[model samples]
Target: MSGQNAKPEATPGVRQFTVAPDDDGIRLDRWFKRHLPQVGFGMVSRWARTGQVRVDGKRVKPEDRLAAGQVLRVPPGGESDRPKPQRRQLSQDEIDRAEAMLIARTDAALVLNKPPGLSTQGGTKTTQHVDGLLDAYAGDDEPRPRLVHRLDKDTSGVLLVARTPGSAAFFSKRFSGRSAKKIYWALVVGVPDLAEGEIDAPLAKQPGTGGEKMHVDEENGQPARTLYRVLDRAGNRAAWVELQPMTGRTHQLRVHLAAIGHPIVGDGKYGGQDAFLTGTISRKMHLHARRLIIDAPKDSRGGGGKLDVTAELPDHFAASLEQLGFDAGMSDARPVAEPPRERTPQEKKQAARQHARQYRKARRGERRTRGAPKPDKPGKR
Candidate 1:
């Protein structure tokens, strides 16, 4: 609840905070999370991680103990508020209820069935985020494991976390290298023509100030690849689809689907009129980060070798299956289609021009047949 009601706005953009008498020696991130839960520790950590969170105008680690009169400045960290684990506003009972769903954990990571509306992390002035309750999630570790990747703040399902920097670094590298394959379950606004296929389009950040707003440049953006197969189509209105993001980009799957005009439900930002959050749809933003498979980096501790971990779909995601018409309990979410080689700009242009020429020929033939009599009028003489 990023202090939803707090008027003590964090310095807009990037503001610096000075350690005060009441805040001495506390971990910088903890202190800030106490004051700014909405801004999230991901922001805090990225700054601190990169020596951007400065103390006395000097960068310090988020774990560094803060002394009184210390000044900390948060550098600009792009637009997507880096995530952190934040404490939720759930009560003791609510917390207890939410516990049965801890789906997976390992020495290197933990995954949770993040419920819709629960944020992954909190910020200074934010009261509760996944990080706010270190005692609960971090366990015996002095500092809790940080998030390696994030589900959208409102999305629910297998959200992964890294227990230590060694693991975080391992997975982070793997994520950057595209070694992790992600599969998602989503109910989209309408049925697609091809039952199973690929959406090869360039996705560029929407050129304005908003988180997660991206566009299908199909032309100028970075190459983003997504492969989706229609699992079930409930008439002309909706389809249950499984998506594999062959390339990792922010909202790649969402953008790809929407570019084809079948936006996912509940994706308020990019799903356009089909966003379930908006009036055009009624289903829960039918999207889930249903599965994650990582070819775990070779164990650095035990002579580099490969390790792989896989997460099955959570219940809600599976339940989404029954609604959308799949064998609700099957564990496999992999797409059946092979990805096509992406056409380069020149090739795509050539194809388009070719299509246009064909279209013009067709139109010309139609005009010659349909409009010829009106034009000649037999010379009307």
Candidate 2:
């Protein structure tokens, strides 16, 4: 609250505030709004222009990002005792449905096993979405939970929600920094040629798909990479695959798989008629957000606050796995452990020299034993 212009007269003077870890990589204006909720955007803009607000003794714009440990100079007295908007009332049915989806909850986070049909955020025609249902998780005076990431509609699995704005900022930074790990399980129409590999294709939105479809556009596309491993196979007809997308692009996994000729089952948008399999297999999308691993809030218990959460397979996806004779729990879809780092040239040379010296020492010891300690020709000694 030090940087906040709350009650400028309460403490009339310039104040220096150190940015907290939660505020790393946040915009200057947002930092003021969070810590100094009373500070208006107009005031922040004026201060930035006149050099009243500075970050680390340097004048910064309202859009400048702030890093942890940076000192923020605050000029007080723009505090506005603005009341928050009234909490939106949610229907009992909506509340019940959302509560039933709760998989895990903590002081700073909420992990939900979002159902396949539920949209993460609302859209033009989307009357009901997870964003509208988040009010169900709010406490009496707590701020509404904020979504940290998005899962595609029909992609069932673990969706993270931040309990407060501070935690939201922290989790957002982790995601943008690529420190968070996400693993998705999907059933594809056919097995890939390789058991495991990386897809480093770039993707761009298609010309006209309502911004819902993507295509691999080598000429002009954003860089996207996905690491995939075939977990199990039902002959060459279908395969269970684990996907880890390094970059968060719209429909990256689906587009990449389709581009590789192994489009995900039930993904007709990209795969066409070949996406679905006839018979007992359902025609629903088989992709499910299976697991997420990221750092927990600093206050969490156990092992420096590591947060690892996994979502169970959705009903249709689970049934597909069973139908294909694949064990739902057999593959955890964890990434392969990184190999040991290669030694530098200098270090390699030093090791070789050390080995050679050890070998020479062993040979000398053997020679000494043969020359001097022959036990005096057995009985002659």
Candidate 3:
């Protein structure tokens, strides 16, 4: 009932606010959490149920997605009695640390090279994490950056952060749809028998581990796939490999490599004691998310091009590569267009037969060529 660009207007104890572009595509309840933090979800639902909340003059549910330029009508009086959370004040050192991890930044995204040993998000006993440091990147008026994906605490690599709620939804869709490509570099204890192959395994959480650990479960598990290529090998002791996960699963790469008898170096949780090397190699995990390529929000630029970024290896990973006589530059860490599909048994047999037929045909042609008298060299007879 009012201009879309105008600020929240209040009249007769009722308030109307137009959704900002940064809040686009999020649930109505999430919108409250971001802009109206004092309002609890239960209150929002109750208001929605009683037709007190309206969008563009129609009743809307709490889970309904909001679009930019939509006007929201509110009946007010939903502030919770509990004390609101106080935003943590970041120290100068924390600000510096967060800035140091930043590798690339755009209007819609922040690409960070998170180091090993730092958690992506805080946990019960975790006080410091990448999520806590995001406050340093935003100003009072800017939307807080949100994580679209996560990396293990010990696996260092390129981590993507969305600059706004709209971008977060966009990036999350790309990741969930498997359109975003992530390439990782790892050092394993033993070389794989095949130079390149795919691991198709189903994974589920181990029951006794309180959902903290994952294991391969053929009968009841989510499908997981990984494509790996051995770049270089130091005899049978170690090998540097490139890993691309076709499906994002918890510890997929680590568990798959271990299942094939070539456990990733320093991944003791999955590989046990065999994960360590005896020599000068660092004990820290050697897995690094080398590169990420994903579609960017069309509104950020001119509706084309993608965000392609690479992260430098951590100090320990680099040192271990040198100690193992492996060259990090050998592989360019390119993203594959699509995951290779496994061939059926019949298809494999058909391919083998075709190959043998072609070989025999070539041999027969060679024999005929040799048996036939060579053409008399240029009228020699």
CA RMSD, predictions in order: 13.8, 19.1, 13.5
- Per-residue alpha-carbon lDDT of candidate 3 for residues 116-195, written as tens digits (9 for 90 to 100): 99999999999989999998887776677899999999999999999877688889999999989999999999888789
**Candidate 3 backbone collisions, by pair:** none
How many angstroms is residue 218 displaced in model 1 relative to the true structure, after the best TM-score fit?
A: 4.1
Query: Lowest lDDT 10-mer window, candidate 3?
Result: 1-10
Question: Can you rank all candidates by TM-score, best first?
Answer: 3, 2, 1
Best by TM-score: 3
* Candidate 2 Cα errors over 4 Å, as ranges: 1-32, 35-38, 41-83, 300-304, 333-381
> Please, what are the lDDT tens digits per residue for candidate 1 over residues 20-117?
44344568777766655555767777877777667776768878888756666755443345565554354685556446546666556666767666
RMSD of 3: 13.5
Query: How many clashes show up per model?
Result: 29, 2, 0
When summed lDDT is taken over every stretch of 10 residues in candidate 1, the lowest stretch is 1-10
Task: Report every candidate's CA lDDT.
Answer: 0.63, 0.81, 0.84
Give residue 187's lDDT in candidate 2 (0 to 100). 98
